[model samples]
Target chain A: MAKKSIKIRAKVKEDIVTVKALMTHPMETGARKDKSGELIPAHFIQEVVCESGGKTILTADWSGGVSKNPYLSFKFKGASKGDMVKLSWADNKGKSDSVEAKIG
Target chain B: MNLKRRIVLKGTAAASAIGVAGLLAPRAVLAAWPEAAFTAKTVPEALEALTGNSAASESGDIKIKAPDIAENGAVVPVTVTTSIEGIQSISVIAANNPVPLVASYNMGEGALGFVSTRIKMGKSGDVVAVVKAGDKLYSASKGVKVTIGGCGG
Candidate 1:
């Protein structure tokens, strides 16, 4: 499967910062079945981390039970306009994808 | 007369045993919830138990944005927002999902009352949104149909 894309849009009001992101990838836990009763192998994003200027804001460790294309919206303090927000997701097979969004 | 009393007592004891077995039956029956909805099947079950009996309903205050039709079953976009105040959490449940509750976000203190995310849909179904505020439960649901199969099919 292609690596999922993560897009972040920052909604700022006064001193509060809200970051929204969507990652395009299948979080397969290798435990599903098909119409034919065959088992689909497990493929999942095991860890996710969102960062602001070297400070960690959120981290996620997904199990095989997580749905595909995990979407997350989070808030953080201390970030202002033009600051950078980074999102990354890594799979159990050692594959990872990362992207950065400049706060708008 | 003593023999008749003994037989009656045995029947009553047998009936009580059957009653105990009946009460313990439903626990095993609900145990076979879907296996591949996610890595943790317990997540959905726990969320349902948290919000008792409140089914998702439509409201102007709540909006669920996912593609009217999904191109891939493996990845689907979902967003939920509410006009209500003091929101404590926002949770998504796929009404037809094998394990209904997809994810739950416990809001930070004084946090905004909206969230957006992409979730996996094994098949077409309504995405149910549950919001917690004012110490009450509110919900809304939107339908998203998956067009193409994306489950390694």
Candidate 2:
């Protein structure tokens, strides 16, 4: 596969797991123009899903209004240490990437 | 010879079509992304597209944490937390953005009613947090002053 663009970390404290993720993306809005005075086509992540142990814990639907290199943080319960939490995102251009982190 | 070449081209086209379908299959399996809501130009339009209702009652239970003044509009950190039970989803809206709706998060079982992320602002405006709980929509907003616009290149 291509080089991963998503960095995710999951930490469990007192039966609650906090997941923080940073995704490397330009998140272009298509409204802005380049130095050449050309419009940039909108290219951004449209959906992000987080799952653990075969169950989805959260799903985020985003637009180009999200900043570049988006950062997301959320918390969940019933997950223990050492369990794997997977975070994945799909962009508007049909490109996607996912990463899994073991809870610490 | 020409007939045989035409047949080969047809077979290749069919194979490529199947390949394209395979690539898009996963996206269809996931929950459908709300396109109309994301493209809405105003907060009421976005809310109507997302929840089928535009009227949201202001609630004190929802908390919006953001800076009073953001130096850079490109990355304004925002967090939304709510104490409402049976929370279904949380949506963040930057009122002055070209497309006001920033992001919407659906909470599954075991997920807390909290979300933190960064959004872009075209200008200084209210950052609204809309929370859906038990089929009712509640919202709270905080004003954010942006010194520099994020959408301008």
Query: What's the i-RMS of each model?
Result: 12.2, 8.1
Model 2 Cα shift for residue B81 (angstroms): 0.8
lDDT of 2 by residue, B75-112 (tens): 99999999999999999999987678999999998999
Residue-wise lDDT of candidate 2 within A6-89, one digit each (tens)? Answer: 999999999889999999999987666678966566678889999999999999999888999999999999899999999999
- Residue A49, candidate 1: how far off, in angstroms? 6.9
Q: Per-prediction TM-score of chain B? A: 0.64, 0.80
Q: For this target, which candidate reaches the highest TM-score against the unseen true structure?
A: 2
Candidate 1 lDDT, tens digit per residue, B14-110? 3432343244333232232221322223434544465543444445688888899999766677778788877776777765544455665556544
TM-score of chain A of each: 0.86, 0.97
Q: What is the C-alpha lDDT of each candidate?
A: 0.61, 0.87
